[model samples]
Target: MPLSHNPNLLQPRVPILNWIADMGSDISDEIRYRLCATLASSTLPALLGSLNSFCITLLAYARLQNTILLYIALCDLIFGVMRVCATNVSWLRTVAADLVVVSGIGWATMMAATMVVVGFSDDTPMLIIVVASGLGSCAGIIARNYAAPRLALAQVIVIDASFKIPFCIHHPEFIPLILLQGAGFIGVAIWIMRQQRETTVRAIAGQIESRTQSLQDPLTGLLNRRGFAEKAQSMRQTSSTKALLYLDLDGFKQVNDRFGHGVGDEILRQAARRLSICLPNASICRMGGDEFIVLADCHSRQEAAVIGARIIQTISLPTVTSAGQASVGVSIGISLFDPMEVDLERAMVEADEALYRAKRAGRGCALLHDPAMSGASKAMA
Candidate 1:
């Protein structure tokens, strides 16, 4: 007491020391009563969280498997009851077996108890009703995430039926309570089913939207740059050899210069449609402005050269623009990927350099990269 007369040191230790002292209290009489109160107070939120999570699970089950909506409802009621009961008594301590038993017994018992209480309210004692409901709720909470929904529901129905005969024969007045509980469970189940349907529809819609975005180009409705990269990367990784052609449209400036930007856009769209028909397996992309890239499968350098030749010939085809007949040819540079040799980006670079050579050589032809002749090209660079 003298040491604590100074407020500064005494105040700092007071709260922590009080808490520590409380933990050491003897578990008898006054201390026991306080401990029980503290435990019960803490247990309430945990119980509530369990109940909320069960409700969410029930909704998820309903949405994911619509055919088992009724089954899920019954399960939810059973597990809901088990969860409530388990708070007061730890029925399944071991993590392994506790999981299965909780779902099986807890959910089934609740449905059974509800039916008995609903049908024979007059005869069924308050103690029996409490025990059944509490045990059922605890079981549902601890059960595995996806143990058959219908089996759980069936067990509940069986239990409910078993409890009814005795109460109806001897004490008919109790029938109302049993019916009430059954009806309540059915009502909750129906609500869960409706929510499940809405969620399922929403999920399906989201998937469709995601697929559309993946396949489509955001600005052009043709396949995007991302779509091209994925296809090219996959083929290069799996196959023996392939080719990439980089094309930058020559005389595209004339369209933008004479007719303005809008006509230039229409020209690009028309170019995409016409180009897509030229090669079946090839992927084409607009790499900003008038630049485009094409990737095609090939077994040898000769096959790749043939594809590049076909592309150059196709681009030279006539198109009727606002400035009368606009014949726009492309300068194409070819780069080939070797399974044991070149990397992905290096192949594109070689193709790009070849493209610049074509442009310098009067922009209508295709140029392929040859490592043997690269020293000469390097000197020019």
Candidate 2:
């Protein structure tokens, strides 16, 4: 084709390509999908740009009757139609990711450069139009594909070659001036793109870090109460029945008073570690201070009781830390209910009631709350 004249090609001045590429894919499959997506982003821009090029090249060919111009027009029609149609089809984007997307960008960059090179030899009026469109195409290429610096720079080089080599040969006296202008243009574009990428990366990364911190307990490396509630919302949609375990550490305050807060903090960390070990397939959270909660798929009272006993026994052992040796016990209250039917708040209330019953029965025991028991039933651990 001649050269793209789409004004909207310049609209995407932001360094979107660099930002998308920086959000790296941890999985192998994602890399291809990301590349395909990036290619898809240029669909509208390329389509519009190609239309201008296609129309002008046809006009130029009609007037000059040049075989090269005719060939360029054909290339524009085929490349433009194929890219626009393939991208719009979802399966084609993923299935033929490497073949289509990589080749598409290759075809596009090559075609743009070819137009810039051939169009320079036209008459004065057509040359002016070609020159203007070529500059616009170069800017669009640099702005949109800045994510891949190699590709962006390669495109700029090709375009600069098309313009510089032809103009320098024709006007031997202006070669020095042309070279200076081209070099300065490329250097400035590179600097601006690098700065834009850094600023965008910092802004997005900071937001993600802040959100992650809000949902975590800094002390025990477990979910906080708010985080637990947020997690439970997803559980409510599942079909399985689950149990809520409300735990309170016994003799924690006495250990803190005797050994200072350092040893107490160590004890708390050990407690969290023990809970994770006991309930490996469960969501665990440190409620506050010595209280904690667990959500797991528990079917019956006997299974819940066995789990509670294991937890109490593990937590009761002496935990030796750098500060000192500290010993503590735990009381567990388990309530089984359908998460979808009863909800987390109501289930937690029942677990809390059962927790008080466990404390009353013995400091190191488990209790299952039932309306019929009236706080009479307890599992001595």
Lowest lDDT 10-mer window, candidate 1? 3-12
For each candidate, the alpha-carbon lDDT, in order, equals: 0.55, 0.70
lDDT of 1 by residue, 118-205 (tens): 3344423442643465445434422321122233334434554555555657767988987897667645544453454345435555
Q: Which portions of model 2 show Cα errors greater than 4 Å?
A: 1-93, 96-100, 103-107, 110-114, 117-120, 137-144, 158-162, 165-187, 235-237, 276-281, 297-310, 337-342, 368-381
Clashes of 2: 0
List model 2 lDDT by residue over 215-248, tens digit each.
7788898889888989898788887888898999
- Global Cα lDDT for candidate 1: 0.55
List RMSD in Å for every model shown: 20.5, 7.5
Candidate 1 residues lying further than 4 Å off, grouped into runs, are 1-197, 200-216, 223-227, 230-236, 320-326, 375-381
Tally clashing residue pairs in candidate 1. Answer: 30
- State in Å the error of residue 262, model 2: 4.0
Best lDDT among the predictions, by candidate number:
2
